[model samples]
Target: MFNRKHLEAILITRTELRLPRTTPEAVGIRSTAIAALLDAWKESGLELHSMMILRHGQVAAEGWWAPYAPELSHMLFSLSKSFTSSAIGLAAAEGLLSLDDAVISFFPEVAPEEPSANLSAMRVRHLLMMGTGHEEDTMGPLSSAEDGDWVRAFLQVPVGREPGTHFVYNSGATYMLSAILQKVSGVKLLDYLRPRLLDPLGITEGTWESCPRGIHTGGWGLMLTTESIAKFGQLYLQRGVWEGKRILSEEWVNEATSKQIHNGDDEANDWTQGYGYQFWRCRNGAYRGDGAFGQFCIVLPEKDTVIALTSGTNDMQGVLNGIWTHLLPALTEDVTADPAAHEALSDKLGSLTLEPPVLDAASPLESEVSGSRYVLDENQFQWTALSVQFESQEAVVTLENCEGEFVLRCGRGEWAEGRGVLLQGAPFQRGANHRMASSFTWRDSETLSITLRYIETPFYVTSELKFNGDELTAQQQVNVAFFSPELPSLHGRRS
Candidate 1:
């Protein structure tokens, strides 16, 4: 368990203003190109939350979709692997550990009594490069370990191949990196990088979820603003020097981002390009640290650009395709500003919004269901009862579940702020305060539809409540999920 003082010390606030904001045209990218990019993404139905483009060390164009504000930090998912790699690089530079160190050496007590030859030879570098030699991903066993000893569980997994000879996208290996960093440095991954990396970058608000043992889950569960991601990409682009100070050795930067392993042979697929130290090589002489559901921090050395994006879509490749198709080819050194195009781009950015439901007109059933309570039957959520109170422009929904009763608000034709938990019984840890932005619409005369977006993570649930006289039927479906997106329908009676 983490000490309270140490957990509290994970937070440190200081703003270092260095990334100057500028127009796309000033940076050699046409403003009309950016406007077109947004239009194309919208046309493709890609649920992008925010985007930040940096060229020549300056922010060229940045915008956040409605309800995804600049201040809000987004979940990084596997992109957290890149940050964990950075911490490992720092630890190596400090001489606390070496990449050549054997993985079992860090946790000698938990290591197998008689390790296999492949497991014994597994080195720290193998973990960074996704070359741990395990035939399959070890994440499944690591997560479901009943004993809660992740280190032991990981070590017990059979290493089927020689270390550094193969590649499997094993998230558990990244977790071991975090466990090693904490074991050697006696601090969490975020805390260890605070002074060396985060402070210099002016990343004040960030959090990394921890494992059962209180070690930071290095493979995922990191949250930071879009600007922070941009700064990190810029730092890597600048060869680990931040504001003229060398935060990381130039040698480490080269090694970490360079192609370290062969992942696949499909030249057309971006993911098949190559794998680095927790980074992925891109098609256009670029490298990136990306996450599930389309979170990205792409660094283009050839173009001298960095593009950061947060999105909620299953089509991760589609998001990258939009960047390559629209934003990349137009990046030139020639400066030519189209005033009219710039004005249009600015207006487009300012007015960018996710359209709320169109069928928001007041329903005939609104008066009949207003302030009425429904006692739901047996369900997975343990939601015993639900009530909706309608107002002129919003509807207040209250639900009583196993956790307790909670209230949420859905705007009639816009997004309204609210709070609720998601995937409560799931394996991952839930934040103490999970926020939501809900929009409600009358799908028909008898059905009330609501879209609840968990703002911090890439998840949105569409719930439909159908009222038929003395009974009600409710169904919920998520936009994207690892498992089934549709949940079992629920029936209830007016109480």
Candidate 2:
């Protein structure tokens, strides 16, 4: 359980060493370069939600797209691994456990009756470095276990090679680390880190999703604001010291950020540089904690800078490339203010909006089919029927599935906010009530396209409804899908 008094103290620290705001030009950076980066990202079709650039312990530039604000806690996905690693570091510093300790020792009861030689040899360090001997990721098998005993199921999987000799990206390994922390600390990972980390850095509003067993999902499902992420990166930049107090030991920081495994060798890309404990080495002599679809906490040691961003984009690498290409070159040794360029950049940032899909003139078929219900053919989504009703400025789509009716409101050429589900009982939705923004456009005389964006998450669904007399065919696609982008097509007859 979290203490309210401790939380209040943490909130008070928000003012102690709050990052001061300044223009990019004042921090020896060219504002035009930041603009160029934004333009490049927009051109490449990357949907950026928010960004914050910090230099010399001050924020140089910050912006959030309209729907994404500064206060909202955006999901950090795998970036949560870095924070989990921090918890382990804190625990190790307190002498609660050692990195060399055999993982089986923590959960003796859950250990196999006769543990395999490779499994018995596995250590906490192997899990940190993603070197847990398993040739393939274990998350799938662990998740599939009927009993949901994740720890036991993880141990049951054969460790094909000796621990610390192989690297396979495994979220299950990180989950084990979280389980170990909970076992040793006698509390959840978040509670353990509250006083040691979040409070000290003034990061009061953050949440980590938990597994069915109540352990924090260590590899993913962390949520924080962009500033919180920047603060985290800045802590690493200052060698784990925050507000002149050492929160994490310098020794732990060194080990955590240093290359623990050789992941890839492609010199052109940041991800190919190498892998730290939970960080990825970048080409421009930096390291970062990143999540799928571009949640980044980048630390540039050589440049004395930290950057944080949250985005819903497929080209995560492109965001990094833009930073390296545009922002890196702009950092200079001496501070030189370019007021005009700064003003222009600020203006551009303030005006940023994700352009909604454009809608053509109302379809000639609108009047005939506007209020008609269509009975849909059997589909994987289990949607039984759908109907479209167009008003003067917006359209309403009502869909019925196994979960019941969902009325999605869509603007003609804008985003209209509503409460609805893209697909009810979707595994990716995680049972959370959806707050969505939807828009619709006519692709042609017979085709109507709709985009539904889950405002709180990094995914969206696009559906195309084609009309041919009394017959309709609907196709759905997701922007960033977990398994497959393709959704089942629904053939329907007007009723």
User: Which candidate tops TM-score?
Assistant: 1
Each candidate: what lDDT? 0.88, 0.85
lDDT of 2 at 337: 76
Lowest-sum lDDT 10-residue window in model 2: 1-10
Best by lDDT: 1
User: For model 2, how does the per-residue alpha-carbon lDDT over 1-495 read when each residue is reduced to its tens digit?
Assistant: 112232122233436546788888778888989999999998888899889999988999888775556656777889999999999999999999999999999989989989989999999999999999999989988889788788888998999999988778899999999999999999999999899999888888887888778888899988887889999999999999987899999999989999898787788878777787888888878999999889999999999999999998888989998999899998886757788889999988776666568868478888888989999988877879999999888999998887788788888888787766447433254555656778889999899999887756677788999999899998888887566787778899998
Candidate 2 displacement at residue 171 in angstroms: 1.1
Give the local distance difference test score of model 2.
Answer: 0.85
Alpha carbon deviation, residue 9, candidate 2 (Å): 26
**After best superposition, candidate 1 residue 450: deviation in angstroms?**
0.7
Model 1, stretches more than 4 Å misplaced?
A: 1-18, 423-431
- Superposed on all Cα atoms, model 1 deviates from the true structure by an RMSD in Å of 5.0
Off by over 4 Å in 2: 1-18, 422-427
